[model samples]
Target: MSSWEIHAIKYADRNARVRGDSFVFDDNHDAPHPMDYFMWLLRRGEEVILVDTGYDDAEAAARARPIRLDPVVALAPLGVRPDQITKVIVTHLHYDHAGGLRLFPNATLHMQAAEMAYATGPCMCHDTLRMPFTADHVCEAVTRLFSGQVVFHDGDGQVAEGVTVHRIGGHSRGLQAVRVRTESGWMVLASDAAHFYENLFARKPFPIVVDVQDMLDGFDRLLGLASRPELIIPGHDPLVCKLFAPGVADHIRRLDPGPTGKVPR
Candidate 1:
């Protein structure tokens, strides 16, 4: 029975008028102004696995333009320092997800080999695909790789005892998700495979995805890996906190924790 804690570190917010074709929607809908970015911290005993590193305060604020919040400030209450993180599991190379990588100097960064290649490769020249990334952020990752601080996983691989990384190419070439074996059941963190529950439940892919078919397939794979659907947590959905049971802290959500621990169906 392994115990784990998950925290959502919000960095910024943007008002996005989601159109019908945007993300499994037929009409314009008001969403919670997309939360800038968040990093999920999973703690099991002495192992501190960080999933995604939210943008750096200064750079994110500058790029976001009129930034609403700082991710580091949000993490202060959690008592998590950049240097304290043991491992960083990057879901992708998007600026929002990898901007803060430099902050964790001592942590071993993990990411998909394909993602790193694409991020640093010529495909980044495409307007649609390149708009979301920052050259500086990607360069930092490249530097880390050169320094041997970044560990690239070719496909599916295990990072720790109960933490596994599974590549799901859609949002990005090497986008991956993390799966953890918890006391109650297995929890699959669907990073960007399914940004919201509707995406998964309705079998729809987000408009920002690169390979729509791959995204859909990834969702299916995520579900198959989980012991139950309730054990899956979608990325960028505020309803995540509401769906899963509360953890040690108010912001932390526990995907598996016995009868009272399961996420609401």
Candidate 2:
């Protein structure tokens, strides 16, 4: 089997209250929460595939989110320069996910067809539907489209010898997760499909959802693709850093789906 190394590079983090209900439907549990923002990098020899280009400094200021490091900067430790990137698999087009597209001038973007339609179509007429997306980010995608820099996929397919992207819309119109083959096994990069393991295991859904049912179903789809529940990585959970040791450089983790030490309570 093809072997690849996967790393979750945390660029920023936030301390906010994730109302239990904000992430769970019909639940009224209010609590303080810490969330981390990341852009995943998959490497096989010299080939590189980046999942989701994280938001830039401008977005951090506009959204009032603190950014510890830029996603592009985070890649330097791994020795991956933007120009070295060949393909970027966009899980979704939210500002935090697709805002940094311009950073990679040499990469071809891989996105879902349904997600493109949802981002560009009439659904954006509603403010609630468009709030999570940035107009400039969407516009950048349009420019990429015209320049033949964007590759659209309908459903699940291989991105490389060991990388696969699965379409499981829930948090957005065409949300997808990446499944990668590693020395440990197949690891699913469940980007926003389950922002926190608590959301998936506990059956709680994130409030910013397009189709609640799709989000709910996405959890199942994630499980199916990953096979083992623990192999799936949540998009915004700080526990990822805790469970996976940091790489030689800061904020980088090499995922290994093996026995873990005692987790802090």
lDDT of 2 at 212: 92
Candidate 2: residue 80 lDDT (0-100): 84
Best by lDDT: 2
lDDT of prediction 2: 0.86
| Candidate 1 residue 145 C-alpha distance from true site, Å | 0.9
Candidates in order have lDDT scores of 0.75, 0.86
lDDT of 2 by residue, 1-265 (tens): 6688888899988877556634765455666778888999988777889999998899989988868998788889998899988799999999889989999988889999999899999999999999999989988888989999998888887788988898999999899899998877788999999888788887789989989999999989988987577888899888888888778586888775432643232
List of clashing residue pairs for candidate 1: 12-36
**TM-score list, all predictions:** 0.88, 0.95
Query: Model 2, poorest ten-residue lDDT window?
Result: 256-265
Runs in model 1 deviating more than 4 A are: 19-36, 65-69, 245-252, 256-265
